[model samples]
Target chain A: MNDHDVIDNLAESDDCLFCSDHIEEAALGILEAEDQERFEHHLSGCSICRAELARLDTAVQLLPFAVNQIEPDAALKLRLHERFLQERDAEPTRIPSPRKSESRIRGRKAPSRPMWTFGSVFAGFCVALAVIGLWNLLPSNESSTSMSGRNFQVYAMQSSDDQSGGHIGADPDSKDGTMMAWNLDPSEKHEIWCVDHEDNRWKVDDLVVADSGSAMQTVTFPKEISTYKQIYVMRNDGTQELSVAPNQAINGDEPAPSESTPAGD
Target chain B: MQSLAEGHPEAMDLLYDRYHRPVFSFALRMMGDRDQAEELLQEVYLRAWRRASRFTDARGSLISWLLSITHNMAIDEIRKQQRRPQKQQAEDQTELMISLRADGISMDTHAILTERRELVRKAMDQLPQPQREVLELAYFNGLTQREISELLDTPLGTIKTRMRLALRKMQESVELQSLEAT
Candidate 1:
């Protein structure tokens, strides 16, 4: 074959181990002597082929390098295995909760409270508050109260329908304490609340709305009222209100009630 | 493997034992952050559990597949973070230079070869930028030349030439270093 024909033929041959297709196996030194000789001949004349052969040789030499074994850390492996087991034991079809996933990403230590700790504490507080007739004592208008070293300000507004309305609670102790202002738009059935943290919870307290006219109701609790550690604001109409605390707010901007607010008598 | 797929706890532990270090090492090398590597290692295994069926021996060994996944994930992470300073990027270059300068003959060639830790890295630095990336994909990442060509949108010939040149350069570098030592 002519030089061009020879080169082209060599390039096209499946058996030409220098070709990129067979370079991997050739580099691994699996090529037969005839194939290796032809590849070496191509390497001697063609700079491109030469460079490739040299690289393959280097890579072969480096194969032993790649063999360096890395011992996995025992502690880290244990931790990963533990997490894997936890995930395996979890419901296979269940989607991971975004909050839990976020915590995992953030490496957040487990909260000191148990799963039911806050719920139970808040539940007990709600049952007692409801049973003691404290809800009745809250005025139909805006009110502010301080209890158990925590401050609370409540605001009540009249729905446009002049029917059941929503209230926004500003609890400074709440995570991301911000003034939460939620008022029932009489035109719509959906309840709305906005939270902010500034000048105590008075802004939110002033904005709380109830079905009872625009009467500004105020309920002050004594500083000595220490029994109530948790605060719950319930809609008098009996619809569940979205409760937010310093820890529960989206951004931890909710404000607590000022200590000066009197306790409910 | 069936147990792992079936959500058996012990299978998860065995899988972890099998893959953690290599995954962590890959992450650390790619991202250069111990904590981030640790976190990424955890995420990788978690993802493996969630997507175990994607793996099969028909394609390659489990370790090779896992390494490929880890490398890709780590590269994605590195791309997401701001690039480290050019100076830091050249740190390996500086290290090779320092070692070469400090010990001309007395240095143990076997030690250098065995370490292979920085030889490939320094050779990589010596390459033109595009060639370096191509080599990185083919060797470090185990991507096929075609995959690399597609990744860089370069011609197949170009990828082949780059790999060829990179490997030649690396060979020359190691040989030269050894010769100089002797």
Candidate 2:
């Protein structure tokens, strides 16, 4: 059954053992083996009980939030980071693989294109198809681009909807960028697009709204910062931008020393 | 995580920046010792670095996964302490609370997220003390209902009832908040 249909059927009792007697215990995961097994069997078929169980699970999961947030010593963070870097660095030298050598050999021996001839037309067509396939494998939109390098820049896009906002960042050295939006319409599908001064729009990514109507997604863009004048998000109806930003304005602004940070997080 | 799994050391730093406070908070709350909490923090992230590939998105958010590790380690440390004499009491609770408020100066990117945190806090505060205590013991202490019943010297049924009532009240409060927000 569809989710709504199951939810509608929730009121109908399926003789749920957990709902009747063991809900709190099951949720706490403290039920004995037999009772826990029985509850799981009942839950698989009882949407009402399952829904209740999920709510209880949420309550348990949220328990940690009740604790006071504590900042660990800066030295602690530094020590852990340095140790991990050392460990990671050590991992590379221990194992040598043949894949790199194979790839390098193949790259050097790659065949060149043949002269144009009547019989060569089919081969040319095959080569064109292969190129298109490889191009498709490469990052077509900004969302899939790998982000790295030191020249990172961030831009905040304010949504016309006061509740919604977005941020985009680009690393010119890495040739890719990322965008994130929060406080969207949870039920609607949103699109991220980059617009040039000439009004040419390039679709960058698509976002699936979270249940809370807030979403953080990473996207990679191909073109350099100068190519796109603005980045914006939209619903399927194409009414207005959910959030938008000016590329040059953000790029020229000096990034904070910790701009490459989880500050927002 | 994909980057971490590919052995990129930089992802470890990013992951630490995202989760260290939450993990440390949880460990401190459960262990009640600053030194032990710091130890747990280092161990958990080190394990994460080695096992990044094992993390699957289907399980939950990265923060949740990190907190799970923190909780597990805290429980282990608590059990270890039970075997030996207790260490001297750590920092004062009042001092810790003040530090917690200060640490929260770093707000979420979304205003809605900030509101949600406040809503949860308010809802939790509204719960009766007995009910709140029982829930906390079961959650942070990782105690089963029976264990909590014995620890608190209360009947098992009473403990279960308190948890049920606490959860119901919190759910109602969150639902009301959602309705008003809409």
lDDT (tens digit, per residue) of candidate 2 on B1-182: 87986777688777776667778777877766778888889888876765565577775667766776676567656656763213223553454543322433344422332464677788899999999888777656656677778978999899878887887777777777768989
Clashing pairs in 2: A142-A220, A142-A221, A143-A219, A143-A220
lDDT of 2 by residue, A20-84 (tens): 56677666544554565456545644667877777766655556666655577889878887887
Q: Against the hidden reference, what TM-scores do the models get?
A: 0.33, 0.50
Deviation in Å, model 2, residue B101 alpha carbon = 11
- Residue-pair clashes per prediction, in order, are 52, 4
lDDT string, candidate 1, B17-116, tens digits: 5445445555655555566667778877776665464456865456555655565566555545734212222333333222222212223533543356
Question: Which whole-number lDDT from 0 to 100 does residue A29 have in model 1?
Answer: 38
Give the Å shift of residue A203 in candidate 1.
55
- For residue A258, give model 1's deviation from the true position in Å: 76
Query: How far out, in Å, is residue B56 in model 2?
Result: 5.8
Best by TM-score: 2
- Candidate 1 has a TM-score of 0.33
